[model samples]
Target: MPTKGMSPVSFSPSRASPSPSPSPSHHSPSSSPPTPRKTLSSSMIAENVDTAESIIRKWSVEDGSSSYCRLDSVFANDRTEAKDFLRSVKNIQSAMQFFVSEGTSSSSEQLVRAQKLMQMAMKRLQKEFHRILSSNRNNLDPESVSSRSSVSMSDFEDYEVASEEDDIQVTGNSVHEIVAGDSVSDLAMADLKAIADSMISSGYSKECMKIYKLVRKSILDENLYYLGVEKLSLSQIQKLDWDMVEGKIKSWLNAVKTAVKTLFLGERILCDVVFSTSPKISESCFAEIARDNAVTLFSFPEHVAKYKKLSPEKMFRLLDIYDSITDLWTEIESIFSFDSTSAVRSQAVNSLTKLGESVRAMLLDFETAIQKEGSKAPIQGGGVHPLTRYVMNYVGFLSDYSGTLSDILSDSPQNTRSPLPESYFSSPTCDDGSTSALSVRLAWLILVVLCKLDAKAEQYKDVALSYLFLANNLNYAVSKVRKSNLKLLLGEEWIENHEATLKQYTANYERMGWSKVLTSLPEENPTAEISPLEAREFFRRFNSGFEEAYKKQMSWVVPDARLRDEIKVSLAMKLVPAYTSFYNKYRGFFGREVGVVEPVVRYAPDDLGNYLSDLFYGTGAGSGSVSSSVSSSGRKVR
Candidate 1:
């Protein structure tokens, strides 16, 4: 028998002769004329014998037996050769009865041999067929042919055989060969091409490119299985030429783009299904898909912009999936480094940013609508259900993390150049001055939200007050530093010029009742009583005040002596009022009022000249002595 690697032989049998007729009855004398029918020709008999011999030889080698040599001993009579042949290869037969059978008998040893030989030949032919297939792979029909041919023989042979068994055959050809038609290849190529084309057209050219690279890597790296051979390991496979792989990838990308566009109907059904099912799937699976989609979508600026343009309803659905993914990521982050307060804080900040961005994108339409109609327009009820609750929970978590993070950072070396206050209200600084922009942004956003919520509005009042106090402190600190610098810049002559302006600003602030305006605001529903137009005007004024302050500082041309006197007087004025108020309100909290009120009143003496003289002489006088002197001098400054 031929081995697997051996070539197959073609068997072209000649036509057989007609069968002989039965003999006439003996009583028929006149039937002497009954002639003998033509029997199988000697050439045909020889052909049959040769076929049987070949079969016997093949089986003998295959089974490692010499049973074919005992044919004559088994079948003694030639006339019963066919019958004897059937009996020899029957269910049970002795060695002596095996060889007497003819090739055509069902039980014949020769018949058994012929069957075995035919099986071997068929296998060899199939091997040859596959060899031809592999050689002509470039021209083969992909649709009709099995791509499983690319799989290892051991891996897919059984499946291939099963498939072949079910397929109809043509004449003498096997199913596999018959199925390889032009139509099959055309269909398959069309499908592949369509996929490629759609990808390119849909602006997913990069993804298509990646697919091509993956295919080439799969093939060249031998990650791909091949028929007729054992599976190759990574090392066994041929290394891919990067240039060739690149070319293939490009081609595939182009094709994919075309195919994607052709099939894409802007139906977000698939996206919706995937996103909806993600929560039901394993977290890792969801993360992988989400990350992949994010990367793919964000890779193209146009796609990102397009995605941003999606209807609020659809965008919210996408954002829901993103939030789920972010939640999972947060969990993972916690698992890995939650013990490290800094790490936890960092992750929380990142998660918050991502969440914020997603929310902003989803609510963009709502924001636009609100902006256009003003907040009084009945909020289109369907924006984001449970969004506020979700945000609150996250904010609470963040607050806790922030506390921990602050503790950790407190232990680190201070950045003296831009130091934060020991107390929360010591000063306020612009967020851009901070190392942690996210932290500052989060703090501001939290404050804003708190201010917005009716229930939480009062809770945030103290926070707003704290911010304002800090801002005032910062201004005071900056002013103290700027005074010396300004004196140096303008020389002593301009001091008078600056002093007058400082006095004017103080008088204006007091007369305009700026502080009173702020203090009274909390008692009124500013939004309810104030029309939208008026509210807008208020915002404009609020912004303009800050802008004017900035412009004044930048353009100021103060005289040196007056600037020094102005700064000194302003500092004294600001501190005296604040300290006096503190003494009045909290003096009872102290064990002795003398200690608290005495220092405060000393600074605000009715005798300004006497207090200045005392201060100049570095003499700390009692408030009683200062008041008596002021009364005697009739110089009550207040």
Candidate 2:
């Protein structure tokens, strides 16, 4: 009756006609070899049969509902009763097996009776199996069971040993084991396992498995439903709006982690433990129970990837879905190791492949959009272009998913050749060669934006403003790289090089914009003595040049505060000292000739300072000029 080593045993009653001596039972000629209970007397056999009959009949379905004992209700507190019940079933089986081997008339009659009792016992166990599964749904929930299964006996022992240490700090590893195990009722698992083992050993595995598959499959499907994994088709996905698809993708991201890490994993663990004595049976059961649901869960991502209405905006979500599957791949492989569940693994792989394709396609579309941008109207004030903002922001978000992109683009084709000069679109300095694919991909996209900005800059008629447009847009792109995860991917060297190029653009703007004003002044040390008329001419030209430069540039913008201030400082350093030197040297010539130079020497050294301060604010050209505010001291009075 002990559950251990409960393999079926063979025995048979005598077939040599009834003995008039009433000599009890004896082995017949066709009887099988003797068992450990070969000497088990006729009385012992009858007693075993009768004991099993009493227990099974009590719990038989033939009884009215008032007297029907639900195994789930009783198995938890009365494990002794559960054990007794299993043992009784096994006893009935042993008795029937004995009768089958005996091959005698009376043995056959007893076999029929034992067989009836065995059937009743099996029927009761089947009900109990269904009852335990149905009633203990909360206790048998996958997440709780998974947490419990993760802890082993060694973990508990480790906890005990650590607890005994005098000054040991409990780091919660040991405590975690206790709490994890306590999350679910072990008694429920024990009851299910016991009933399973008894039924399987007694040649009723089909019934046991049928009940298990039916109940657990429903739970698995329900888990999938709650996880928000819908049975979406390609047509349906294509028809859904991006907003709805985005919501579903978000839900799937959350669901997949639970489905892969807890639901399927826990079910595998539960199946393995419940049918520990029969591994093949356990695997088959888990495969049948979870395969379809897992496929459905994994298939959702593929459906989303296959949606025809692809856009660059959806690339991040695709990357997210791809990343989730990649992150859980190892667990997925381990949980679905059985050949029967290979479709789940394949579906996951397919989803990843399709997602990579989708992501690549969207990236291409984004690049094409940048290249084909037809907005010819130049940004007023040479400020940041809309294309620049859109592209940089998109690339910045892509950099946040660099790790995922590296995996996706590792083997993906890239356009290594660039239309721009090598120096303009320089190679990125990645910390690892493995990330070169992503670095190159992102750098190329940024390069495409830069090229487009070049085309946009040409739309500005003022050559100086065109340079300013390039500087504004490039500075914006560089700043975006500096602030976001792009800094890490592109590296310091890349940032330094781009910043140098930005400096070049700034210098070009300064040269083209203020060159006329800078050249209007006499040499710092004039070679010839200047006549009064010549000095007046020099002052007139200087005043005319300064006003024209200031008025035109008043409306020009530099959006970055630091860059704006730096440019202002640079312009003042160049213009202020030279103008002061020239003015001090020549002002007396005008002063001595007319007793005042106010009519001729229009701007003071300090006035240049005030004028340069107002530059790059994008104030309108109609704004008041510094010439109207010049004071008696030849400086602009605030």
Candidate 3:
């Protein structure tokens, strides 16, 4: 199918075939000779090429402009031309083997002249081949370009390449026709796009991998994935605006997308290229951005009124952080979950793990922000307390998703230990401690918050209220760790310290509150001017004080069942017995005075004991209190 004006190479079918006869025959030829696998074939090629060579040798070396055209027709400005040229030289080398093997040449002189001509042409072609290879290498390596299949200029200029292996556009024009483009770069892009779009999704990753490699090449050549500079540290990374880096990556991808729009590769490969070669983002890089966005997250909008009342916003922020990180890994997880190959799977896992590590460290930024809050001068007051509620609420919040977070934080030191450091009591115990780095950091941070709360608790002028405040906080701390999975970090020992402190507060509350009432009861004053009047008055004062204590404290709430009961029991032991005894001593005096109206029979010890039962319920104190001078149940009997 050579054009009318173009010269063609004539091929000899009979010589190429295994037919012993030189001329064409009607019968099918014998099975062809096996191609020599060990060495090149020295036999002359088919009659067509042999006849064409004679014609080629007839053309003069001085054929001027026609010679250039002839060579241009044969040689492409590409790797294909160099390869073909070398292959031809190899063929000539095999042909020349006859010069050595034909031991006795009857027409020796004619054979020598023909061999000389063939040798001259082989040497000339070899020299031209090297020069062309050098030129191509300077522009781009021959090996790199040679791997790609050649596309004819006609495929782009006019002819349709839509033979099904190359896709067509909506307009029915082929991808090659659309991007056949004038230059080598354009042709490569167009051909690659055509191949990619035409390829099916399933069972073609091997072929599709070529596209990925090409993308990597383009990225390296164009410097799309990196700048010429060195890596930045976490601090410096934080300072930089990543918008440009992200934007450039997006822009490069968009160009590839637009070029390949008509011939789409699956989204999976696209994502791989986009993320893998986008840039060298490190954990430190993610740490900066994740940290900055996370800074406003964990604290109260205004100062929280009490230690236990963190707003809902704090939990919401934590959930949002978890969600954002989930989104970040979504693509990688998808790729891994698919029926990917060993190499791609390994890549996905490595990517996910590194990303998990960096972002896990980024979660520590939340720790940093929380720790920074702990760094503030703690609030010092009775009405307002430290951020115990906020801190514990966050603990419960994080614990809810520990299973999922643990997967991400797995294989890492962060997931090692159970958290919560210590209470503000300066308790005699050190943490039982977790093995992982993350657990240690989180545990220490919890202790810091407690210490802050502890310092703030000491500010109260009323010792009983202060102790009660701390006791309530400690109970809550213990309950938070005890009830949730946080027991791992804040071990049983830490929780025991909280319980002990709570009991200590209960004891302190008893000593401070009831001591005043107990001292107010006057000793017998037999020598006084009005002994009977004095006795009645002492009964009145003692009765009033005891009633006041019960009235004021009945609504105070202690959450721990055991502590609440013990406090109630202690009050009962001290108040009931003593009050009953004092009442017995004064009752006769009241009646003997005759004017005192028997000093209002008031409480029997049992009546006062009932009032003490209501202390430290979850409800706070209320103001309907009147004084009551009660003895501990044992003291009344004494």
Report lDDT per candidate.
0.30, 0.75, 0.42
**Candidate 1 structure lDDT:** 0.30
Clashes of 3: 38
lDDT (10s digit) by residue, model 3, range 406-476: 55655666555445433422222334523334344445656666676676666666676666667667677
Give the clashing residue pairs of candidate 2, or none. 12-101, 12-102, 13-102
Estimate, for each residue in 1-638, the C-alpha lDDT of model 1 and write its tens digit.
Answer: 11222222232221121222323334456655423331233234334545444443432323446554422221122323322222222211222123233222322433344344433332222222223322333433222233322323232112121121143332212212222233433222322322333333323333433333332222211211121112222232224343433343343333322212211111111111112222222133223222322222212222222332344434333333333334344433432221322343343345334434544454444434323432322112111113333333443333333333333233333222323222222122334443342233333333333233323212323332222222222233224323433223222333443334445543443333223322322124332444444543443443344233223222221223333234335433532343334334433333333645222122222333233222211123312222122323453222
- Which candidate number has the best TM-score? 2
Query: Each model's TM-score?
Result: 0.21, 0.83, 0.41
**Which regions of candidate 2 fall more than 4 Å away from where they truly are?**
1-40, 63-77, 152-184, 415-435, 524-529, 592-598, 621-638
Q: lDDT by residue for model 2 over 1-638, one digit each (tens)?
A: 11221122121221223222223566689978756565566668888788777777777754564365543333545344555566677777777777767766777788778767777677777777777787778888898777755555232322221111144443322122242343344546656776788778877787788788878877777777877778888888888899999999999988889988889988998887678778899999999999988998889989999988889998888999998999999999999999999999999999999999999888888888888889867888899998889899989999989889888877686634433343433345345423366776788889888988888889988998999899999899999999998887767767898889899998999899888887777766532477778878878877887888788888888887777877777777777777777788788875544555357877778777667767777885322223222223445522
lDDT of 3 at 42: 30
Ranking by TM-score: 2, 3, 1
Reference-based lDDT, residue 376, model 2? 66
| Candidate 1 Cα misplacement greater than 4 A, ranges | 1-106, 136-181, 184-638
RMSD of each: 26.6, 8.9, 17.3
Worst 10 residues of 1 by lDDT: 262-271
